[model samples]
Target: MSFLACRVFEKTESEKTESEKTSPKVQKTTIYHQLVQMETDELTAGDVLIRVDYSSINYKDALAASGRGKIMKQFPLNAGIDLAGVIVESDNDAYQAGDKVLVNGCGIGEQYDGGLAQYARVKSDWVIKIPEAYDTRQAMIIGTAGFTAALAIHRMQVNDQKPEMGPIVVTGASGGVGSIAVNLLSKLGYEVIALTSRKSMHDYLFELGANKVVSEDKLGMSDKPLGKALFGGAIDNIGGKTLSNIIAHTQLWGNVASIGLAQSPNLEAKVFPFILRGVSLLGISSTNCPMPLRTKLWHQFGKELPLPDFEAIVSKEIALEDVSPYFDELIDKKHHGRLIVNCQ
Candidate 1:
């Protein structure tokens, strides 16, 4: 059976020539995306087939679909990075028909066919049985964004971070991962200082349970090797000076989780935070995360990390047909909440 998918591909010379033949004014775009019908046989090789109920639009998904970032490793693939649904078929005994499952990262969107379709075929190893705490829709609501947040927090705690150590400031607190991190961290009993570059999102961040909402302009970071310990720890999404400053201000024995480099990837800072303060900088890699830990984090989503305000965090839901135009919204940074795609 053929199903509709948001397919991303590069036009071959023949295809482009054929296109120019049809429309004399234009040849073809370098990277193109559209809704197209595809059969299971055309899907990338995998052992498990999933009837995808929902998938979320993430930063990487937007980047891949819009061709604004060099994220896709192959052409002729679907573009969503995370999905939740029910298993329809599985070659492995560990899974059976009708079991709820979710998949994020593991190279599905970039190197293989991904979740931006009504149906998906993925490696059995990439599948996680959705815990009862979250249905398919809820799973996509959290999606890859929440998975990264949970992994960051988990790592921080494992590194001996505690609420009593001091407040945890979340950088880039207006984005998907940052917003969810704010909500979850506040609920987890840590004092959360949400940092956003936009002053308009301060109220929204506070609504997500941030004890304090701040912007970089409001905070004066020091040039000293180790600045005043204003925070116990930090979950930094935007790297560069912000990351360096966060590292400088983090209290003794604190843990800092570096999740993204939205602002800049460069870092110029002294080693005092790490050497003198005994700070731990944990690198959270959700994409290529091992299956065992991935499953554990997803399970934690159903348990301790449940987001009652997922509705607030999930700003919009669009049909699969409406996926393309929305990438520009993400690209322009006009959106603050998560956007989930209803593949059904």
Candidate 2:
């Protein structure tokens, strides 16, 4: 359907009373001002209904919200990819009312209505019980970006990455995934080098536990098939030549987990890094991650990779009314760190 035309209306007490009597089955209305109003019948199909407490902005969400990219396959769909909230209704045995749960990726804000509204209906299979250590807000603070970072680290560790090998580098270091990867990798005893185009965020990266911060310009591409091995392993958020450079410079037997294509999706690199150096370029997809692995990683995030200063990574917390402008800011690359949406 075309996006619901923008309009505003409020029910009078008499209208409310009359409507309640006329349609006892209708759910309460939720108005997301400047966006759209949603009710029970309007929600996308799902087995569980969540009272979304919080959702957070991601690059994809920015694209969808700002009408800049094909992030949303359906018009009028809710457009935040990460959500944490309490379950209010469920048709699945795995979850019940009052459970604190979260949904990330799985085509949310893309193929389905997502978490920007006060409530969302989502598949039970996509729902993860919030970790014991995290509150609703904290869960969204980590959101999809942090979760993807953790997934990248998990893949690297599975490939036998060790802290003693050498330093690990995180590209796009001021962004959500990069910042959390820096924090989590440092906490795991790895020397963390953060690379960013924004020189102003160097101190911010340091505060997030980066051992060093390097300018993106310093990581220039080379014609050589392999460059000097600078990082033992890397979590790359900006793809394209940045990713190729990381692969070229990764230590022998090291792995580089590529989690995004913010710079560009194209990769122009030789097979030397993989053939001669035994380097592995791993792809991370938090969206379609298998259920068992998704659950395990989230649990590990709570137990081992907890960000004690998660609030520090949140660049802003805005109400629904403020989302439109923030979308523009995000698409223009004018914002850094995570942006939390208070959907309550």
Candidate 3:
């Protein structure tokens, strides 16, 4: 059967050798994306074939759609990092046909075919059974974004981070991951400080359980090696000077979980926070997280993390054909919260 999918293609130009490397006339790549009908056999070879029910948009997916970042490692592949569905068939004995499953990362949207289609074929090893407490849509709502947030919290707690330490700052506080992080942290009893550059989102952030909302421009954070200790720790989405500033201002022995680099990836700050304050910068990589820990975290979402305000976190839900426009919205900073896609 044929199904609809958003396929991303990469166009390349002639390459220049070492001698011409300095020239602006070097190799260049252009990205193109669109929705098309794809036959089941056209999918990449995999042990499990899933009828995708729901998928979600993330900054990473926006990167894929906008051609701004090198998100998809392979061209002409589907473009979604998270999906929830039921198995249509399975080659592995561990999963039978009709099993409910979900997938996040595992190189699906990057290296292999992904979940932007009405149907998907993926490795059996990459699949996780849908939690009993949630259906496909709810699973996608908590998709990769929530998964990464959980990872950050898990790692921070493992290193002894506590609510008693101080308020936990969540940068990019109105976006998908940040919104969920604020809710989860507050629900878990930590004081949550929502930090965002957008002045318009303060009320929304407050409604999401932020103890306080701080505007980036007003904060006037310093670029010094060490600043006044403000927060106990942070879950930072916007990187660059913001991350550096957060690092400088974090309390002693706190953990700063670095997730996204919306501002910039370069960290050009001093090591005073690390050396003097015992602050730890935890890197969260949801793409290739080990299956054991990944499954455990997904399981915890239905229980400990609970995420009672999940419905409030959804920014919009669209069909596969309408997925392209929201990418630009995300890159332009005109969108906040999660955007889910209904593949079927």
Worst 10 residues of 2 by lDDT: 1-10
The CA lDDT at 110 in model 3 is: 84
Kindly list the per-residue Cα lDDT of model 3 for residues 69-122, writing each as its tens digit. Answer: 888877789888889999999989999988999999899888888888899999
lDDT score, candidate 1, position 78: 91
Worst 10 residues of 3 by lDDT: 18-27
- State the C-alpha lDDT per candidate: 0.89, 0.82, 0.89
Tens-digit lDDT string for candidate 1 (1-344): 78999999876443444566667554445777889999988999999999999998999899898887888888889989999999988999999999999999999889999999999999998999988887999998899999999999999988889999999989989899999999999999999999987888988898999998888866667877799998999999988988998899889999999999898999887888999999888999999999998988888774766664788898889999988888879868888879999998
lDDT of 3: 0.89
Off by over 4 Å in 3: 13-28
Clashing pairs in 1: none
For each candidate in turn, the TM-score is: 0.93, 0.88, 0.94
Ranking by TM-score: 3, 1, 2
Query: Top model by TM-score, which number?
Result: 3
Off by over 4 Å in 1: 12-29
